[model samples]
Target: MTYTIGFLGTGNIAADMARALNGSGHKILVSQRNAKTAAALAAAMPEVTIAPNETVVANADILFLCLLARTAAQVLPGLPFRADQTVISVMVDMPLARLRSLCAPATDIVLTIPLPPIAQGGCPLPVFPDCPALHRLFGDRNLILPQPSETALNAHLAASAICATLLDQMMTTADWLAAFTGDDDAAQAYVAAMIRGYLSDRPRPGALPAALRGLSTEGGLNATLRAAMAPAKDSLRNGLDGFRPRLGLPLGPEP
Candidate 1:
């Protein structure tokens, strides 16, 4: 059965989700806050259209909320929300409890983390302990990881913020390689494919240790590079652990 999916914000994640869902039979209604993005998405997808936030709330069967947590407090309470429509927040740092209060009377509230690659399928999608609505929407498209608690979801939230930085790091290396190869495209393709293949073949249960052991042969180039990069990796991990506070999330060691 087709559902009407309304997006309250047209930020990165929302845009990507709309892009991925394009051509699907579901009706996709989007809020007009980020007018440029909403218009572009509507123009690109037949099932998608731009609408006022209240209209989106009233018309949609499901709402994918991407508003900033800081502003959500000021914005959501003003709009009338239905008890029957499911509200799935893709915003970071905003707890389910707060969302419940703001979107009260609308009990089917859930939390979700969607990566850009979800449109292409095969990425890991994280949702709350008992949110079946999320699984129904994203389960077949990606690996569904049903986190046991909000804390667990937050841990994933911190970790999820690193994908772009990881890409940037890869691009830095690729740029250096471009200098040698005299072709940025070839260097990027090679680096991207190499890194992607490494990621694809990562060991299931004990990825970090298995990756270290598998890649670092004695006196090998991989071993040497790993040693040189240890500090940077540590910084990245530390930075991720502390990033939630910047997003206004309650920060404690991941439970």
Candidate 2:
């Protein structure tokens, strides 16, 4: 079914969603708060209309809250949100109780984390409370991982924070390859393709450990490199563990 989806904030996330939802038969209404992004989206997707937040909220069947936490706190209360409309929030660190309070009268509120890759589809969307609206809208292109609880969803959000660090490491590897091969573009392409291929080849559960074990051949370069990077891996684990308290998860068992 088609939806009149409105974006409350026209930031990068909003832009990406607009791109993803383009041609989905949904009437997309994006707020004019971020003028540049909203304009760009309207320009790129001629079907998307730029409107004031009030108009967007009033006309939309489903609204996506893509604003910064502070901006949301300042803006949401003033908007006219209908009780029948569905509201999905992508605001990081915003608690669900606070959101529900701010978006009162609109009882169908969903919390979800959508990555930038959502623009091109195939991104994993971690959602709380198992929203059917989300599945109906994005399930065709993305993986909708429904969490058992808000805490589980928050943990997924915390885990997603590691994406930047992983990308940084990929870039570093690409730079090293470029230094050796004298071909920057080729180095980047090769590194990206390598990672993509590896991931695509093992897209099933338990594939990670199996892949690691397979690659760790005795006396091989893979084993040597894996051993050398053991500390970095440990650091990644420690970093995730550190987020437990902040995400309301208890400390894991002692290692």
Candidate 3:
């Protein structure tokens, strides 16, 4: 079924979503808060239109809340949401209960984290409360990971921050290669292609550990690098543990 998808905030993520959903046979209504982004999206996609926040809420079947937490708090309370609309929030650090309260009497609230890769499809979407509307919209192109709880969804969101760190590490490796080869573009392309090829294997459950074991062959360069990165791995774990309090999870070991 085609949907009237409304983006409550026209930010980068919202723009990306608009791009992803452009030809999905659904009409997209993007709020005019970020006029430039909304206008650009409308110009690029005939199915998309820029509209007032209230008009978006009044017309949409599924409303995506892509606003900042502060902006959502300030804006949502003023909009008129229908009881039939499904609300999906991508705002970081916003709790489900708070969203439910702000979006009431529209009880179909789902929390999700959609990364920038979504525009090109194949992005992993971590969604809370297994929303059928989201599945209908994104199941064909993206991986919809139905999270068990809000905390689990939040954990997935927190883990996504590692994408930046991974890219930084890749760029550092590319810089080192460039220093040795004196070819910056070639180094960067080689490093990016190598990483992409490695990740494209789509490891099955328990396959990651096997891949690591295979790579860490004793006395090999991969083994040497893996050994050297042990401290970095520990630091990554500690960083993830640091997010427990913010994610409303227990301070100690995960239950």
Candidate 4:
């Protein structure tokens, strides 16, 4: 059945989801907190309308709380929601208990991390305590993975947060290439294509060590790069370990 989906905060994540679900036959209502963004989204998608947060929450069949943790905490208490409405949240650090307390009238509340790639149908979307609405809307276009526990969900969260480091590395690599090639466009295109192929060829999780060893030929470019970045890799790991505490989760091995 078609549902009216509302987004409380129309930020990048919400906009991405709204864009992906635009023509999926669901009426999307967004709040006017960010008027320019809301208006832009309405113009870009079908059946997307801008409304007040109160109206959006009250009328929505499924409401996605996409606000930052602080904003959500401040705004959610005053919103009116039906006991039957399904609530989904994209805020990373908000606990399930806190969400339930704040959105008590809503019987079904799901916690998920809707990554930006879903907007382009690129990767699986992660949800905890599976909900049918997630599947009904996004399953066809992308993989809808209903994680069995929040522990598994946090692994996805960690990966999502690592994009900043990856981008930093990629830009550095591209810059070095451009320095040698003297052509920025050629350098960027080459680095992007190489990275795409590398991602596509990565081994299954359990066999990563073997795959890494196999990919680095003795005296090859991969080996040389690995050697050069060994120290940096250690530093990067130390930096990423900090994310777990911020999200209120234990630091541990990622799947």
Candidate 5:
């Protein structure tokens, strides 16, 4: 079945989703709040339509709120919706209860988070998969995940810090290797391959720690670097510890 999906915001995240849905046999209705983005999307995908925000909400069967947390509060209160309309929220760090309160009386409200890689059909979308609409949208790429309590979700938000932190470290390592070898392209290629291999080949849950444990093989060169990096890893733990209290969760015992 072709679903008519309404996008309440046309930001980068929304655009990425639109690109994925383009020519996928889904009807897309885009909001006019971001006129340039909406027009661009409509131009790129002939099936997408540029409509006023209110009209888009009224016409489409499924509504996706892709706005920032602060903006969502202001926009949701003023928007039009029906009791039968299905709603999905993509805003990070916003609790499910808050979303339910804001969008109550809808047919169903789903809380979800997708990484930016959805455009390339590579995102491991974590969502409350109870809703059929979410199931259809995610297709086979989704990880069927239960919505953790708000506290757990907050912790996972901190977990996202690891991605940027690791990527930056990889980039620096690539640059350092380039300096030593005087071959920039080769250095980047090598680092890229290492990252892809590590991610693709690793086992789940204990994979990262297992890789680190392997580095400690009866005291080797990698073991020395692992010892040196202990302080940096501790700093990361401390940073996440500090964030817990800010979100009203107990700091607990620091790692």
Candidate 6:
């Protein structure tokens, strides 16, 4: 099936999802906000259409609530939603319960976190619990990481923030290496491949340190780099520690 998907916002990420699903045989309907973006997406994808904001909500079988965090409250109540529709929220830090209360009570509200790379089919798509509809939409294209409970969702939120932090640091390092080494493309490619390999080979449970144990070898490049990155990693750990209380999530056992 061809499901009617209504997108409530016209942000970059929202447009990216629309592009990812382009020509997938599904009908894509976008709200009349950010007229320029909506028009562009509609033009690019034959299946995409620009409808009045209210009309999109009422007509869509599945709603993608991509509104900005600041304005979702003001915009949500005004949309005409159907009782049996499935509403999937992409806004961060918004609880599922709050989303349920804001939308039509009969609709199933699910919270999801979608990274920018979804346009390239590499998104770290995180969803709460299980929903067959969501499974059909994103299960094939992205790494669908589902959390078991609200506590798990909070951890996922922290993970999302950590992803941004890590990416920023990685990009900055790549830029610095490019500037000093006079090989921008090579620097970025090297860093990207390094991180990908590291993540792919990461060990589980107590095996993590063992996996990284080779780094402590005497006078090695890895040892030198680990020393340089130690303070930054410690600071990140402290920041994550502070976030746990704010998220109301239990702390993992101390090592």
Whole-model lDDT per candidate: 0.83, 0.89, 0.90, 0.84, 0.76, 0.80
Misplaced by over 4 Å in model 5 are: 201-206, 245-250, 253-255
Estimate, for each residue in 47-155, the C-alpha lDDT of model 4 and write its tens digit: 9999999999999999999999999999999789889999999898898889999998787998888878778775577898898988888888777779988867776
- Model 4: how far is 92 from its true place, Å? 2.1
Q: lDDT per residue, candidate 5, 29-129, as tens digits?
A: 98886888888998889989988888878877889888898988887775677788888878875667777777766647776666667776756555563
Error of 3 at 171 (Å): 0.4
Worst 10 residues of 5 by lDDT: 141-150
- How does model 4 fare in lDDT? 0.84
Task: After superposing candidate 6 on the true structure, give the runs of residues whose Cα lies further than 4 Å from its correct spot.
Answer: 199-211, 214-216, 245-255
lDDT-sorted candidate list, best first: 3, 2, 4, 1, 6, 5
lDDT of 5 at 158: 66
1 versus 5: better TM-score goes to = 1
Q: Is candidate 1 or candidate 6 better by TM-score?
A: 1
Residue 156, model 1, lDDT: 85
Task: Arrange candidates, best TM-score first.
Answer: 3, 2, 4, 1, 6, 5
Better of 1 and 5 by lDDT: 1
Q: Which residue pairs come into collision in candidate 3?
A: none
Q: Write the residue-wise lDDT of candidate 1 on 1-255 in tens digits.
A: 789999998877788888877677899999997988888888889898898889998888889999999888888997879999999998886888999999978989888888888767777877875677667666666688888888778778888878889899889999999998899999999988987765652238876678768887988998998888889887886787677665555666453
Candidate 6 residues 1-255, lDDT tens each? Answer: 889998999878789888889778999999878899999998899999999888888888888889986688888885777788988888865677778777865458787877777877767766776667777887787777777887777777776778778778789989999998999899999899987865542234655577589557877988988887789888887887777776777776642
Task: Tally clashes: model 4.
Answer: 0
> Could you give the C-alpha RMSD of every candidate to the true structure, in order shown?
2.4, 1.7, 1.3, 2.4, 2.6, 2.9
